[model samples]
Target chain A: MDPARRLGPAQIDVVAQLGVSTVLLGGIYALVSVGLTLIFGIMRVVNFAHGEFLMLGMYVAFWAYTLLALDPYVVLFVSIPLFFGIGVLTYVLVMRGVIHASHNVQIFTTVGLSTALQNAALVAWTGDYRTVRPWHSAVVIRALGMAFNLSQVVAFAIAVALTLVLFAFMKWTHTGRVMRATAQDHDAATLMGIDTDKVYRLTFAIGIACVGAAGVLVSPLYAAYPTAGLQFVLLAYVVVVLGGLGDMLGAMLGSLIVAAVEVVGSYFFGVAWKEVFYFVLFIAVLVLRPAGLFGQRGAETLGV
Target chain B: MPALAPGRWVAVALFGIVALVPAGVRDAYLLDSVILILLWGALSAAWNVAGGYAGQVSLGHAAFFGIGAYSAALMTARFQQSPWLGLMLGVALSIVAGGVIGYLSNRLRGPYFALSTIAFSQVLLIVASRWRGFTAGSEGIPVPFRPGFWTLGLGHVAWVYLALGVAVLYYGVAIWLETSRVGYQLAGVREDEDAAEALGIASRRLKVYAVTLSAAMTSVVGTFWAQYVGFVDPFYVFSIDLSVRFALNTIIGGIGTGLGPFLGSLLITSLETYLRATFSGMKTGFAGIYLVIYGTALILVVRFVPEGLTGLAARLRVRSSRAHA
Candidate 1:
């Protein structure tokens, strides 16, 4: 009757399944956090409405699927572009005014934006949870003697592909270089005749587009609701900070770490405590390394 | 700090009207709305202590509010203890929680600090919901209705007075802090932490004090809210929407001013009531249309009237004075 004897092969298999699932879940988180990191990197403004944007993406996919009979995967093109345009409009109309404002103004402006978007969605769509469960939504694929949701696997693949594409774009594109330079030193970038304002607008758009993409990918697996963004955005913040604020690769890595912690910790402490676990981790990371695991020194002090 | 100013008399007159007007109004709906306005006014003022004066925008104040509520509700429901005692305990616990949050987050400026606070509250919320043995889970704890003086039951009129008293107490504290040397140091910290540190002000300690004071007051307001509703639930009390509403009221009324939070609460509550009445007939989605308007108004206020209604009033006064000259 030794407690150690109770640990069996079945339990180990369960743990292994959890690990694989965590990695897949982390890919989706990485996709969401990457854009958040990019926006924060270039412009020091934390978009509190970032989650709302994801919610918008989900709704877009949901509606397109429901109305146009489009697949969730196919709706990414429309959602991404729509969200990009919305992002650009937000930057132009709202965020631009507060770029030079005080921290209080900046924080509340975005907070206000988040409130408006969330409530407007609630008003427009009601609080009903809508999901697009196309065929193959529940298909299970066995890989390496483990079962995986086919939809989740596809979403994971898309997430990784998008991240790679973004990395390449940032590396090879002139616009990406300009964004990095602006993020490094706004004054210096402007001195070099780079349009920092345009860079900021684009960075915000791209950041939002990333979340929009995530929304489309997630619609098959999850329900879309007005407050859905609130749930994901918190985890995105955790991922962004854990990876190091404004560090792209760090965010991707951080997402996996957070996902692992979430899955493994939930197994031990029950599912309800998962959010508590990550939030504690977030505070600990913030206290121990405010610059984040991959962020540059003194990044935490920027734009504060 | 002047004596017998015309503005002071007007304020005194306004206070007198608010305190005595409830006695004449017998409509339950009107009384309830007034009570809510007073409650929100106190809550927003409490938030303004750390947010407006100290310049640390906390997006997770619902933690302290929920803590205060749950403590009072649980104590009253389980132990049959007086809610007043529970209120005191809640205040103490919230101050401690505030100190912890401040100590952990004071190093972080702006949005980082705000997010940390949100995370902290979210942790508390999860604990509140999961620890069903203590909090009754999401079903929430209900305070047994006892019509007695010790239970602080004195009818709706009495409740109005109680809420008004708390709001006045918060207003008095805010005014005092505004004029005190500590207030100046907090303002310094808000304006620029580095500059404040260089001026020999201990920014961390000061911020902790500000947050603690704010939490203490916020907890009291939570206790009142729980008592008013006769229930306490994790989602109802610890909601991020509640936290956002606190900030919205303060910002709309005028942050860092004595009358700002109160005025903001009055305007917002009235608008909410009016909108609910008008839009209640709509079948779907109309429930939150008021909130949409509120949100848009909040954005507009932040964008154009950063100083809030008080600032706008001051501007008008200066304009008239110059025109007369």
Candidate 2:
């Protein structure tokens, strides 16, 4: 390589540092967007409260850490099951009616739920920004001239591992197959004696559980606040849409792309500029590729 | 004009009563609440044009609202111009922005369109908060309390009248839309886009028109809000909560009916005001008590009465009529 073309060691370090942070950010984003995409893919209903669920998870973990002196990661065990039940109850009470209702109803119902949940949290927590300080949170892991927190690294590991597990379950498990069948064709799945309603409820439960898990993992990384989910949720939308709505693989890829754009864009244009770029990209994607990168032809206009 | 429906008559009565609120209630606090109702009612009505009639369901309307508020705020504070000129500028800019947004999102439906509006609004929010040099950022721009006809008003009563006038204008627009041919076409577009397009309704054009008109009306009210508040903050103007509030007011009242948003705004804003006053001294969880009720009401309303309060009233009236028959 020409000496002029070759990057200096410091420049290489910067690139690697950005790359690692991007993946770390992408991992959490992927975790969130995966659940959102799955919900949309299976139920064709967007969970506007996905981030709130994550916030709830963060709160749970925060509480667990504060009251019981438990490690934040241990709360994952508590959150997954708790959020799964909450998810099932949500579907039964709320989503069931709107599953067949108008798009506006579906959208508003969830938006209402989100507003209620967010405000309820605000009421409960007093809009305070609570942080989870795991013992390992301060430990910096340095490798190859890059530095990151142990908690963040662990969060990234759990995120990627859970994503694999989700992929495997979808590929191998019977419930996953049924969910996929329901996603592919609701009527056909019903005609095949697949118990499509059960599949939908299960899909919603799993999606919520995934986000809940992500939220617990996120507790140590981000501050827990009532509106904390707002930022993540919008970013999740961008990632989900960029990857193609309702596409798991696309969500993962979109997460990386979006994180890269944000990280690199932030490096150059400042923090606010990064948001502007992503939002513009979000609109661009919607306008130009409504079906998303990995989505089916009719996914964007599903149930229209 | 179309034959006066029961809802239309009720709306007229509602506005008439609301117009005289300042006369009966002399308390500044009470007047402030009424002004909030009228301002929000007007905004909800404006949002209803595109969201209700054309079925756009924008969650990004704060961008336009901010555009108007800041345009006037910046003009009055920075350029030393009359707010009326700012109003004209704001409307023109809002029109262009609305047209662009409507055109861009012409083909989007449901959640996709809603999300796009949010993204668009977020962009504005970020810009407003970040561009400190241009917008004064979150510290906000203070509009001098220049009390005159050119300044837009003199006292609390004058504001109530001003707000009432704007609200009535929005109501008139909604009535016109419901009665006009363009309104019918917009309705057609909302109901079934493909079918409406097949009928040569020019769906895209009508949708854009609805959004453009909606944006203009919203911006006009934005100017009034800026002047009324005498301070303009990016957070207050460009927040998603404001956008969602518009939708919530419309949906809770009765989207597509044109008269629903005002009713919705009246009920919801009153409830919010009452709740805030009741919980003003509370702490912790009580801090968001008003929002909790507001959100729960929204959920319960959407779930049980998707047609909204007006729709429920209409239904009740129909049942009574059937019983009599």
Structural similarity to truth (TM-score) of each candidate:
0.97, 0.97
Local accuracy of candidate 2 as per-residue lDDT tens digits, A1-304: 7786467787899999999999999998999889999999888888888899999999999999999999977888788899999999988987887887777888888888888899999888878899999888999999999999999899999999999999899989988888888888899999999987788888889899999899899898899999888898999999988887778899999999999999999998887678888898898888888778776666566543
- Each prediction's Cα lDDT score? 0.87, 0.87
Q: Give fnat, all candidates.
A: 0.76, 0.69
| DockQ of each model vs. true complex | 0.73, 0.66
Backbone clashes per model, in order?
0, 1
Q: For model 2, what is the alpha-carbon lDDT of residue A68?
A: 96
Q: Tens digit of lDDT per residue, candidate 1, span B165-264?
A: 8888888887787889988988988888889999999999998999989988899999889988888889878888899999999999899987889889
Model 2 TM-score on a 0 to 1 scale: 0.97
